[model samples]
Target: MVGLVLEDWASPSRATASGGEYGVLMYCAKIASRAGHTQRIFVAEFRPDSDTQFVSVGIKHVRFWTLAGRALLSKKGVLSSIEEARMQTMLSVAFGANNLTFTGTISGDVCVWKEHVLVRIVAKAHTGPVFTMYTTLRDGLIVTGGKERPSKEGGALKLWDQELKRCRAFRLETGQVIDCVRSVCRGKGKILVGTRNAEIIEVGEKNAACNILVNGHMDGPIWGVGAHPTRDVFLSAAEDGTVRLWDIPEKKMLNKVNLGHPARTVSYSPEGDMVAIGMKNGEFIILLVTSLKIWGKKRDRRSAIHDIRFSPDSRYLAVGSSENAVDFYDLTLGPALNRINCCRDVPSFVMQMDFSADSCFVQLSTGAYKRLVYEVPSGKQVTEQAVIDRITWATWTSVLGDEVVGIWSRNADKADVTCACVSHSGLNIVTGDDFGMVKLFDFPCPEKFAKHKRFLGHSAHLTNIRFTSGDRYVISAGGDDRSLFVWRCIHAPH
Candidate 1:
C-alpha cells in the first residue's frame, strides 16, 4: 500500500524560496534565463542484477560510465533546441512489436517520427496547433483535429495515410478546429468525429457528413471523450461537471451522470461494463455501463485529477493528478489501493497517465518538472531518475505474454513539448516537440524479457501519441504547428 500526499504546485513559494514572494518571484525571473536554454538526454539504468548499473550518452558520442564508481556506457550529442513558440503537444501509437508511431504539435504543423533519430518523416500537416488525434482499429489510417491560425476560426479535422512521407496524404476537411476526435463504431464502414463545439460528424471513405450537433455542456467546453470498447456506447466528460453516455447507433443519449465535479478524464472498462471518471475535485466515480448505476466513488478533492485509467482486467483504477502521487483502488473489490506518493522524487501535477495491459505498472506524464514510474500491484517506484519532460505508456509484452512496460518521452529537458502516447507491446515509444519533429525510442528485449529495440527520430515538441488496437502502429498529433504524422512499426520482435 502506498501513501498519498497531494500538494498544489502553484502555491506561494515564499516558504521554500529562502525569502518571501518577492524573493521567489525574483528567483524565477532569474531562472527564466534558462527557460529557453537547450539540454539533451543522458541515460542511466539498473541492470537485471540490480547491482551493476550502466550510464550512457555523453558530449560527443554515447559512451559508458560507472555504477559503483566504474564506467559502463555513455553517449552524447548536441541535440538542437526547438523554439519555444513552435512546441505544442505530442501523441504516440504502437504499430508493431517494437515500433511506435508519433505525432506532435509545432506551431500549426504536425510531424511524424519513426524512432528517436531526431528527424522528421512527415512534416507540416496542419495550419494551427493540433490539440488531438486518433487512429481507428479497423485500418491503419489516422484522424487529427486541431486549432487553426488566427485563433478566430476554429480548427479542422483531417484524415491521414500512415504510410505517407509528408503530413497527411489525403485530408478531409471538417471546416472547424476540433478539440478532440473520437472514432465510434458505425456499423459497415464509418467512424464518428466529435468536435469542440459538440458536433459529431460521420466520416467514411466516400462521404463525410455532419451527424449531430450535441447541445450539451452549456457552461463550458467538452474536454474528454471515449467509446465503450465492446458496445456502441460512448462517454463524454465536460467542464460542466457532467458525463454523458451516448448510444452511437441509436444516436441518442443513454445516460447523463452529474459527477458533482468538473470531469476532466473518462475511460471505459476493458470489458465495456463500466465507466471510470476522474474529476476536478480529486475523486473517481465508477458507473455501471449498462444500468448507469453508481457502484462506487472515491473522493480526495485536494488536487485535480488529470487522468484516470482502468486496469485491462477492470479490477483496478489508476488516478493521476496535479498532486505528486498516483492512487489505485480495486474496483472488483473495495477500498481503493491506498494512494502511492513517489516520495519527494515524484514531481507534482501530472498531465496524463497509462497502465500496461496487465495493470502491473503505471507511467505518468507530469507538469511537475519531471516524470515518474511505479509498479502497480505493489505500488513501488521502479526507476531512480526523474524524467525532465512528458512520457507515455504504449503496451506490455513478455515471454509468457505477461506484463511488459512501454514508454516514450517528450520535452526531454530540451524543448517545450506538451503531449505523448504509446503502444501495447512495451517495445517502442514515440515523442514529439516544438521543433515540429517526431522521434521514436525502441526497447530491446533483455535475455530475461525475450526481446528489445532502440529508438530514433523527431525534431519538434510533441503534443500527443496514441497506439492502435493491435498495437502495430502509432498516430501522433502535434500542437503549435498544425500537423499530423503517422509511423508504422517496421518491426515487431516477438
Candidate 2:
C-alpha cells in the first residue's frame, strides 16, 4: 500500500491509500487545493512472480490534475460546467433505460436515487447492509439483494415494483446467504442465483419454469458470476482459486480453468469471444473460450486488477488496477501498450474507471475522491485540478459524443464534496450530496457548461449515479434516507 496521510492541510484534507486490485501494487499521492479540493497522481508496477523483479509497465511519473476547478478553466484555459455536487459513494448502474443506481446505508436503512432527485420510494429493504441492486428488462421493476439478514442468519432477496411502490416479489428462505446475484436473459423467464455454498440455482417464471440446480468444487465462497448476453451460459469464480464455466440450460459444468490465484473478478469480452479474470495475487489472464487456452503467457503485475473491460470496438482491453494507473492492451498485439498514471501533483488510488463507447477517452476516480478525464489515444488530462474524496464508484453515460459524461464532486463555496454528473453535449450538469441538496449547472455558452447551480434535494449522502438513455433523467441509490430518487433533467434552453 502506497498513500500519504495529510496532517498539515485544511479541515477536510486527503489521505492516500494503496493496495493490490488483484496482483498489481499502485502508489497514489494525494494533495489538497485552495478551495479544499483534492487531486491524486497514480503510479503502477507489474511483475511475473515473487522471485522475479518488477517492471515499470511504462506508467511512471505521469500526472493527472482535477479539471473541475477555476484555475484550469480560467479565460486563458476555459472549459465548461455540467453539474453540481462534489463526490459520491456510487454503488450500482444499469443500462437500457439510460439509468444509474446507487446503494448505501443510512441510519441502517437502504436509500436509492435517480437523476439527483429523491424517488419517494422507501422500504426497510434489508436487516443489514444492502450489497447490490438491479433493474430488470421489464419496465418499472427493480431487484435488491443483501447477504446479512437482520437476525445475522441467511440473507434474502426482494423484488420491487417502481410504479406501484410496493414489494411485488421476493424469496426469503434460501438456506445459505447469497454471495452474489446476477440477472441475465435466459430464454423467456429465469433468474440465476449463485450462493455462498458453491451452488447455482435457477429461478424461473411460470412460462419458463425450469428450476435448474448446479453443483461444483472448492468449499470457498463464490467471487463473481456472469451470463452470456445471447445465450444461457454462465461463468463463476471462487476464492478456492478456480473459474468454472456452466451451461445454464443443462445445469452442468461445461469446463473449468484452475487459475493459480484466488479469483477476484471476471468479465466476458463484449463479443463473448473471450473471458478476462482478475486474481487476488496481482495477476490477470485472458482466455479463449473455444480452446480455453490462457492468452499472452499469464501476465502478472505487482497490484491487483480491480476492473477489466474490453473497449467498444473490441480492439483493446482496458484494465483498472489497485494501482492508480489504467492500462490497455491491444487484442491483436496481445500486450499492454499505453498506461495513464495518477494526475500531476495528485497521487491516489483509482477508485473506478470506464471507457467511452468509441474508446477515445477514459474516466478515472482518484483515491482522494476526485474525478477527471484522460484522452485515450494521446493520454492527456482534460480538466483542471479539483478535489474529491471517498469516491466509491463511477460509470460512463450511454449518450453519444466525443466527450465523456458521468457523476463527480461539486464543492460550490465550501470544502465538502457532493455527487453530480456532467453531459458533454449540452455542457450541462447536476449534483447532490450528504446535505440532500441537488443543483444544476449551466455555462454561458453550450460549449462552457461545466459550472454550477443547486436544483434538487436529498436527505443523505449520495451513493450511486447514472444518466437515462434519453439523457432526460438521472438515477441515484443508497443514502441515509432509505429511499430511491429519480430526477428529470430540465434543459436550460438554447
Candidate 3:
C-alpha cells in the first residue's frame, strides 16, 4: 500500500477509494508516491546511512529513502538525458563498491547511480528484463538473472566485476517456454536460479553443467489440483498447457502431459487409475495417471470449465463450466460413452460441487452464491429437504453449504470465499479467499464468524486449496501470485 491508489496496478489514474483510515492506531505518519504510474516495491535494502541511505526500486520509479530526524523522507532518482531517452523501470537495487548504487532495469540494462542521479548505463547487460541480482564480495562480483538471448532459451545470467563495465554471461539449458529469471542466489560452489515458471535450477561455476533442481508449471495460474487417492503425489493443472504430477515427499515433479490448450481443473479418480482435466476451451480430457496419455476427450460446450470432480465411488464424472451447466459422463461403462445428462437451470455459472458418498446425489455451488442439490446420472434437480439432508457427501467444497455457514464473515461479499476443502477425517476445514488468505476452521463451522487462524502468503486471490491424502498438510494456489504453497497441518490448535 505504498503507492497512491490507482485504477489498477498498470494504470496511472488515482482511485477514488482508499484502503483504510488508520484503524486501531492512535497516531501514525507515512509517505506515498506523488506522481507517475503505480509503483510496487520490488526490493528494499538496508545499509549504513551515507549520501545514499536506503534504496528501493519498483515499476517505473526508484526512491532513495533517508531518515530526517524522526521523519522518513524519499527522493526520486533523476535520470540523465541519455538515460531518460531509454528509460527503464528499475527492477532491482544493490550496493556496489565506493558508496555507489546499481539498479537492474526492465530493459535488461544496468544503471549505475551516484546518490539520486544516474551516472552511467550498461546497455544490453541482459537480453531482457533483469529480475533479481545478488552481490557477494566472496565472489567479488554481482550475479544477475534475466531473460535469455533467445526467447525459447533459458534465462540470461551474468557475473559483473567491480567496475560494472565488463561481465561474463551464462546460458541456461533451453526449455519450451522462455525462461524469464525471477530470482538468483549464491549457493555452495554454485548459483541457484529461479524462473517465472517456478523451475529451480543450479548452475556450477564457469562453463559447467546446469541442473534442474525443481520443476513446476512454467507459467500461468494453477487452479486445478488433485491429491492422489492414497499416496504422497499431487496433481496440478495450470494454464501453462501442462498437467503435472508432483511427488509431495521429494518435491520433484514426476510426470507431465501437455494438453496444447490451457488446463483449468483436474480430478484424480478415487480408484487412482486415471485423471480428468478440464480446459479453458471447454474441453475435458481423461488421461491415465501412470503414463500421462489421453484416455478420452470431449466437449459439451465451448466455455471455460471451471471445475471437474470424480465421484468417490469412481462411477461418475462431473464437469462444471462457465456456460451455466454441469456435464455428466457415466464412467461405470468406461468413459468413452455418450453424455448421461447435462444439469442446468442455475442462476449463474457453476463454481464448485461435491458428490454424495454413495454417488447418488450432488451438491452444487453456483457463481451467484446459490447452493443447489441435484441427483447424479439423471441430472435431475433435487428439491426434497429430507433427501438432501440425509445424503452423505464424500467431499465438502461448495462455499454455500448450510453446515459451513459460519465461514462467511458478516457483510462479506458472495465471491469473497473462492474455495474451501474438508480434511479426509472430516474434523477440519481449509479455505482460501480473495484476500489471499488460507484459513483453518473446525469442521461444520456453523457459528457466525467462527474462530479461525489465517495464514497469508499469496497475492491477489487464492483460488484453490485442498488437504493432502493423509490429512497431514494442505496445498493452496494463488490466482495472481502464480505460486503453489504447501502447509503442514497441526492436529489440534485451540
Candidate 4:
C-alpha cells in the first residue's frame, strides 16, 4: 500500500518492490541481499522442518540459503548447461515430500532440486510461464497456475499428484476473458485463487467450475464511483472503459457494461432510475439504471468532464468540466437536454460540486482554491453571507470548504486530498488523499490542524470515495492500483 515511487537498493537487501509481487514469511530476521534481478524477488520460503535451510526464487535466479548463527550462506541453484534452460527465470517455488524443492520456471517447466542440486526437470508442467505454485499441505499434491497449450486458453489451475502427473485443471474464464491466476492457496476444503484481474475465486474440488468470491477494477485510476440512492449496490467507472455494478455484503459484481469511453465521474439520479456518466472525452451520458440503455448523451465541451451531479429534486443535472465551466440541463424536459445557463467566471476547472437541498443553488470547488456558490437557473455567483449561509446542501463532497479546511496539511499539495464525502448522518467526513490514506474527521471540522484517524490499504492516490446509503460502509477507489476497497464504519461516540 505504498504511495511513493519505487527506489532501487533502498534497503541493503534490494528486495523487489511488491506491485509485480506477493509476500510470505521468511526464517531470517535479517535478510541476505543476494544477487538476482534488480527489480523483483518472486517467492521465498523456509525448507520443511529446517530453520537453517531457506529458498528464494526470482527472475533468472533461484538460491538456497543456509543460516548458521549470524553468517548467512547462500548457494546459487545449478541447472544443466542446456542452451535453453540457462535462460529460464524462476517465478515460483514450493517444498515437496522428503525435502524436494520444486521451482516453476519461465518456460513452463518445474525443476526439482534436492539439497541445492537440480535433480530433474518436469517438461510441459504448464503451457506458458508458471506464475504461482501451492502445495496442498495436507495431501501430497502440487497446484500450479498458468497457460495450457493447444487451445492456449490461460488460467489453468491444475493439480498434480506426488509423482507430478496431471490430475485435473480448471480454466476460470470471467465474462468471456480468461483470467490469469496470480496466486493460489487452499481454504476450507476448496481451492482459493487470486486472479491477475483482481478477483478471488473459489473452485470446488469435484467441479471444475469456479465461483468468484470477490472482484475489483483492473486498470489505473478508477475515478467514477457512486452508490445507489436507496439500494445496497454501487457503481464504479474507470479508465478501462468499464462501468461495473457491485453489491455490498456479497461483494459480488452484479453486472457491468463498457460504454467505449473512459468514464471520469458517475452519479445516480435521485429517483434511482437513471445514471449519469461523465467521460474522459467530455461527453456525459444518462443511462437507465436497470437496462443500462442510453437515455441521453451530450458532448457540450471538448475537455474532460471532471464531475457530474443530479439535483435532489431530480429535475436538473449539473456537469462540471476541466474547462472551468458548470453546465446545467433540465431533466424535466425529457431525454433531450434543455440547455440552461452555464456557470462561468470561475478561476479554475471545477473539481467537485453539490446542489442545494431545494435545488435552487449549487456550490462548486475549483482547482484554483475557490469554493463558489451559484444560483441554479440564473448561473449567477452568490457572495452574500446571508444567502449562502441559509442554503442546505443535498450532498457535501467538496474537498475545499470551511468544514474540510483541516483536511489539508500546511505542506500538502492541491492534489494531495483528492476526494471527500460526509456521512449520511452528518456525524463525520471521510477523505481520500494522494498518499493512499483514508482519513476520518469531524464533520464541519473548521479548527486548524484538526485531529483525524488514518486508514491505509490502497496504493497510490484514491480518486473517489463514497459512503453507502446507511453510512454503514465506505467505498474507496484507487488511482494507480485500480483497487476498490470497502471499509466498514467504526465511528467513536461523540
Question: What lDDT score goes with residue 388 in model 3?
Answer: 87
Specify the highest-TM-score model's number.
4
TM-score: model 2 vs. ground truth: 0.36
Ranking by lDDT: 4, 3, 1, 2
Which of candidates 2 and 3 is the stronger one according to TM-score? 3
Question: How high is the lDDT of residue 132 in model 1?
Answer: 56
Query: Is candidate 2 or 4 superior in TM-score?
Result: 4
Q: Where does the lowest 10-residue lDDT sum fall in candidate 2?
A: 54-63
| Residue range 355-421, candidate 4, lDDT tens digits | 9999999999999988999999788999998899899998999998787889887799878899999
- On the 0 to 100 scale, the lDDT of residue 113 in model 2 is 35
lDDT of 3 at 433: 90
| Residue lDDT tens for model 1, 1-494 | 11111111211111211111112233333211111113342222232223643223212232222344333332221223533323333432212112233343434455443333223434555565454555543555566665544233222555555553333222335453344443222335555555554445566645554444343453453445554554545566766788876554454566677777787777777877778888877877878776888878777657777777887767767777767667777665654434433223466666666676556767665665444567775667766443312323333211111121222222234234444433455545444445544434454322232222222222334445544444444434333222223344555245
Clashes of each: 115, 91, 1, 0
Which of 3 and 4 is the better model by lDDT? Answer: 4
lDDT of each: 0.48, 0.45, 0.77, 0.80
The sequence of per-residue lDDT tens digits that candidate 3 reaches over residues 1-494 is 01111112111111222232222336666543333236687887754335436788887788878766655677788886663555568898777756678899998889888878888888877878888888775555788888766543234777778677556666676455444788888756688888776777788866646888867676778888888878877788888998888776676677778889999998889988899999999999998876777788888879999989888878788999999898888886775746888786867888888999998888889988889988888888998898888998898888887788878878889789899998888877888999977777788898889877666556668878888787866777777766667666655434
Model 4: residue 24 alpha-carbon error in angstroms: 18
Stretches of candidate 2 off by over 4 Å are 1-212, 216-229, 246-254, 297-300, 335-346, 384-494
Summarize candidate 2's per-residue lDDT along 70-158 as a digit string, tens digits: 33211111112323321222222221233323232321134433433333324455554344455554564555555444343323445
